[model samples]
Target: MTTTGTIRSATGYLRSWVEAQAAHRRVPGVQVAIRSGDELVLSAAVGVADATTGAPLSTGHLFRIASHSKTFTATAVLRLVEAGHMRLDDPIGQFVPELEDGGSPIARVTVRELLGHQSGVIRDGQDGDFWQLGRPFPDRSGVVAEVLRAGAVHRRNEHFKYSNVGYALLGLAIESVTGSTYAEHLQASVLEPLGLTRTGAEYDPARAEEYAAGHTGLLLGEDTRQTIEHVDTRAMAAATGFWSTAEDLTAYGAAHYLGDERLLSDDSKRIMQRLESIVTAYGTEVGRYGVGMALQTVGERQLVGHSGGYPGHITLTLIDPVDRLVVSVLTNAMDGPAEDLAVGLVKVIDVALTPRTEVPPPPAGAPPLASFTGRFASLWGVLDVAELGGRLVLIRPTLTDPLPGVEELEVVDASTLRVAAQPSFGPAGELVPVQRDADGRVVSLRFGGVTSRPVDEFRRLRSGMTHLA
Candidate 1:
């Protein structure tokens, strides 16, 4: 059975790519999910869910997505705000008064600040030793005490400071406002409506067999990986505690799309996706942060999503709003290359979906652009000239990977051409000067001080050719 669509070839390419990357990264397990609109276009998984037991990973295996839970919590908060239960500007003290009454300055932080990570709340308590798998995550009471210990790390809206503790307080505020536990409120407000059955605020002991055990020490290679313990994050679940499968998470991500009314209004979605702050997260120069997500521009495409890095898990998700594409890569290893893999997969799919220019066969006695075609070799690498949509184009070729792009070439009397709609050498545009042999046979092409000769040395014997002129 063959699949068909703009992404049909992409899934196969992605599957192989994931397989190679997982092996290269020595990650125990990996799962990827991609969706186009409401359809699940691809869900591929590789490696083992448990390196110790050698359990194969699958799209259904639950992964502790860590910080991705912030997007969920932020979504839930936005839902309440739209429902008149809360407002973005409302002071945190109004809901969870413990901090205010307890003399913690975080009470003065606004919901907007908390949602955007501008609340100036400490990221984690001083003893974030919990993340090392040495100590258990804090409970509800412990979490509140940690907030008290957290205090303020910076001034409100001063800069994009991340705060896991601030998100935990948001959870507490949700509990206080709804008179329900954070788990219950999130489940009722977000999961049920979105039909996300495989997602939850915390690990479920009932589904213990389905839960992939986290691993550590991949630095020593695959064989040396040891199973890390899994403990309930309790109150911190809202910040970094949600466990979900790749498919479910992608589905949840799709709900944030503009036309999707199943979970959030278009207005709410806009607000949540808005770039509220400039930030650098997890050592990556992420372009911006939204209400609870990260925004990046890859090539000409705008992608908005979140990255998750828990103790034994690392994941990256991206959604292309213009194309309604959602892609997620999840891995069950501390050293997993989820971000690079996810971004690369997105780019691969983007290429697969791009409509290749269709050029009718050159008319008989045509300018014979084929002379300009064929591979050219230089010190830098190999570049290919090809005809597309009846136009000559320049393309750089790679040995193992697909060509990323082709620049359209405008022929100026056969030898001189300028790049179209792109800049090559100069800021706006640059000229590509092609030199021919004495016989007017193509020999060498030069651009931006870089030169390439015909891969076929026979072309060197042509009439107008240089070096041998």
Candidate 2:
């Protein structure tokens, strides 16, 4: 179990780092939510919802959490199984008999195989132009045609092969078994039961302004990104068509924790989390997949969650079942750093929870820790000083991952911080002197001989500097 103190302290540092990193990466918008044990520790949003309009983003903004739809689909399937409506070993042809007519290899694909991505179904079919917005997403008839059109590209259970078509078939199966649409069934069975009001199986145009507009990536030597319109996924809502906020996503992740009976029994969760396939790309092991969920190893902790990649949104959610910790990071950009941000949150929490035995006390007349924290810059790069778990740490704001080679600092006096512990190459035992304005605002700080000014002041000074011979 994770202590509340640990999460609260970690989030204190994480909030500042998240805000700075989004600015540094030039990401259009980012939404993050963290849950530890039974508490919602943090909910934060940074940057703008629309780059063109510069609409400020909020925690309530919804993002297209693409492939994360699979997790919900899998949960729905398991619920049906619990009710004796379906079984994992059931063949697809039993529910959709039309699939068996064309000598399509998918006719024999089992529910379990599809759930674990072992069905050998073609990935989005040959004409997956819908992904690139060249055409609209397929309808139910089109999805069935896509499955029959390509059939199986590999032997069933040969290896893990991700297939959006496969999951779309599962959605159809759910609809057939329940006699309801996929969206309606999922809403009544899953989202409503979980009380997740901000989540939906597909895009809803009625709530347009509530959604954070997606943006194209910085592509083809273009620095500015254009907003992408939201489109209904049609028949493929199960595989890659879900919209949610970070807050709601974390709540959904929490219900997946082992032994939690809110959704499924422990027996079912064990099966869902059991390793079913090793996801590989280019002959190298990339990740591990279970029945709908993704498993990851971060430091010594094991996490289960999913990542999503929609047209203009990138999102990731990670859950530490043992500690009962959940984190979700959603971004409205084609090249959002959602995974890295989530991993950084985990690392920061780990650091906060790790016991420290040598923290020095603040010197007399020292400036408050809050007063010394801000983003500082130099010709080298940008760095942030943040107070984490009652201690101060200096982190590089420009790095995609924020935790590597983090430096700890101790209060020295009203104008200084002592580098307590850092990498050997860093200024580990030196004093960083602070310069302040008459209003008690930090103007600059010097690490050893190198001076770092407040980011705003540094930019202003650089703009006025004269060229030297």
Candidate 3:
């Protein structure tokens, strides 16, 4: 687990990096939150909540955290199982008897299979255009009708096949057995217990303005993104219809850690996090799925969390149980880089938590580390000189994963640094001259004999340069 002191030491740089990445990636807005143990180490927002109106995004704004609802529904079902209200082996058709008619194969699909996405249920029926908002999301009768109408797509337990409809059936089963709506049960059993005041099982129209407006992606020949309206998911709420902020989402994730009895028993959490299916891409194991949970391994550390995609928002939350660390990234753009941003945070934190003994101490009379730290812009791209764990390193903030190609620095003097080490093909042994204005603020620098300047100065210089004759 990343200790509290280690996380706090990196949060200052992390915030600035997130701000730069959001602007460079052209994401309209992003919300980020981090939790270590019981403390919220960071809650930050960058860019505009509504690009059309230029409203600055804030941590208070909510995002339609679609698909994260599966975690909540899964928790509710497990709680019921613990209370002796239901069994994992029970066929789902017993609670929602509508599918038993016509001797459908879906009648034999067990609750465990649905939870693990092994039921082979259809992805979303023949016309899942509801995702595109062409029609209203299905209600109870519509959910039942879709199952009866389409039946099963493949044999049960054949392989992992994600189906939003399968979760919708679980919602119905929760209602039938508990005699309460899914929202009510979830609120009482999970949200309220976790004290996630900013989260909800569905979109609440009363707080409409508090919700970040979803936007169209940069694709589809559109020059700019247009806002999309939030509509209730109706019966599909269990699968993809929850709203939350990065802070509350991380708070919810913290409860899933083992031994945090506020949510599930450690044994149940182990069951929920066990590898039930391996998601493959081109014969490579890309990801793993547990009972309604997504499990990942990042840099020898285990992680469990989920990613959400709604009409205009893309979000992800990762929990490191061993380190007791959690990170959530929420974006109000259809093509938001939530996954990249979330993982980037983890990588940087890992770098911060690493022992500094491997990094050499500065030479005598070396200048303050902050003096040379800034963003330097060249005609080709941008590079950031940052002080992490009291060591100066050059980072390229434009790439999807920004930590690769990082170069360590050994200060030669107040205005010079030598690239001490880096990966192959990098300028591992180059002297960089730092330039400063009269106020001692960094204004320019040179890497590998290539001149770079501050962003504004570089733009001005480019605009005034004469074209080749």
User: What Cα-based lDDT does every candidate model obtain?
Assistant: 0.77, 0.88, 0.88
| Residues 299-336, model 3: lDDT tens digits | 76789989999999999999987678999999999999
TM-score of each: 0.76, 0.94, 0.96
Runs in model 3 deviating more than 4 A are 355-357, 464-469
TM-score of 2: 0.94
TM-score (C-alpha) between model 3 and the true structure? 0.96
Model 1 poorest ten-residue lDDT run: 353-362
Candidate 2 C-alpha error for residue 297, in Å: 1.8
RMSD of each: 8.6, 2.2, 1.9
Clashes of 2: 0
lDDT of 1 at 255: 88
Error of 2 at 405 (Å): 3.3
